[model samples]
Target: MKSSKPIAGRYLGYREADRAAPYARFFNPELAPLAPHVCAALDRGGVPDILLPDIDQATTNLFGGEAVLEDGFVLTSDGGMRVSVRSAMPSVTPAMVDWWFGWHGDAASKYKLWHPQAHVHVGWRETPPAGASGRVLYVGQTSIVDEYIGSDLIRGAIRFVPPATLGFTDKSLDDDQQATIICAQIGLGDAPIDIGYLAHHVRAVPGGSEMRSRFWMGGRHVAGRNLIGGMAAVVAKRVLSVTESDARALLVHCAQEMPHLASFLPELFGEFKDAE
Candidate 1:
């Protein structure tokens, strides 16, 4: 929101936006009014309850494709936080979700299209290997991005992984047909240490698809690259743990980005899925 792109600093100003891309219509260059549902979800509050970092059981709830804590943030008892946001995406599919994730990381322009106001820049480490397509293009790749969770600018690494890696044992998950869940390990910048986990579960619905996004930030998932880093993380954990404000910010970010993405994802995918 400050400058449309990051202007300076370590993780900022890496890439500039391509204003003349064919995907321009796929997203707005500005923010629109929050949808009514989004407003309501932000109004109501969520508290951390039974699903306290127990992702195996929580993944079961997600597979059902029903609304469970449909929206809002939960401050976990373990000094971590969880954010839940469900977006109803009309005419969007699980395959499109996969394609979008894989395709967007290729350029900062495409990444900005997901959330113009919040997203600043993005770069891919190793993506779309030879002979890899669809979900394969991104499932094993890592994307480094500079974006805003709320008012704070964050530079983080998102490493996509298979559902089995996160304990989503549903038999139908092997393919991205009926449902597609994008799971990732979240880290601070390019560091080898992982600090969080996230899953965006896009399940088939009657009209289109619904994405149930979940984030588990901090808690036992936080780790370091080595023994020295581990000690640093321990000290940092006691001093600067995730809080309610962090959860609320993440909830708002997810709530905004997904719907904006679904708005034009179908058309975007249809046009560029094969070529791009």
Candidate 2:
């Protein structure tokens, strides 16, 4: 290599002496000849591991070195490892790394635009038409009233449903009886189902008044605008993580009470046939 300046000449001058020493030892005179060039290379952009001193001692203790040096290459106690100085760069902003690892990117991305679809209960002031139970399955658009109901459920839209009244005497609405009633309501319908209803919450939001109230059933929740979708999404994610095919197949079973949705389950989940 051509010498760039007096600094490079110094390394070239010792080239012959460094050549005489063992290549593996740090003090090898032959290799010492290239130390300056190595330093220069590191200044430009090189792995500091090469420039680390006392290979024998530093290798044993990455952190146990001359007390004078606050930071430089790191050596493990066993003397078998060496690390570059770049590892310290993370101290500048720890949160950046934390955010990258901590955020649920995959889950958030799936439902940010719309909550995941999950099952929901719908009740009529009057009983669903006799033998018309299958039509009860429906999918609805996202709405705050639905979301609010999903949160606590007691003070929200569910109150108008039978599960809130006939099913539960506690008035809390979370009682087992109420939940069973709700589950039964979900069972009444099938997939690819749509229904219309008056939206009580939309009028409060600007431009919401113009939007008609309707529900569509297939993917998940009956209420579109509520947290119910989020809850269902979480469950689905968990199930899919373990067994994609099994999860998709089990979703088909969700339509037991609602045969309409179940009838089309084969089509909706057919794509996952090879998930295993």
Using all chains and alpha carbons, the TM-scores for the candidates as numbered come to: 0.87, 0.14
What lDDT tens digits, residue by residue, belong to model 1 across residues 164-205?
899887766667777888999887774566778899988889
Indicate the residue-level lDDT of 265 in model 2: 23
> For model 2, what is the C-alpha lDDT against the true structure?
0.22
Per-residue lDDT of candidate 2, residues 31-103 (tens digit): 1122232234334431243344432332222323444221222222322222222111111122222121111
lDDT of each candidate versus the true structure: 0.75, 0.22
What lDDT does model 1 reach?
A: 0.75
Q: After superposition, how far is residue 115 of candidate 1 from its true place, in Å?
A: 0.3
Minimal lDDT window, size 10, model 2 = 207-216
Q: Which 10 consecutive residues of model 1 have the lowest summed lDDT?
A: 9-18
The root-mean-square deviation over C-alpha atoms between each candidate and the true structure, in angstroms, is 3.6, 32.7
lDDT score, candidate 2, position 47: 26
Identify the runs in model 1 with alpha carbons over 4 angstroms from their true place. 1-17, 35-37, 51-53, 64-67, 132-136
Candidate 2: segments with Cα more than 4 A from true spot: 1-81, 87-92, 104-276
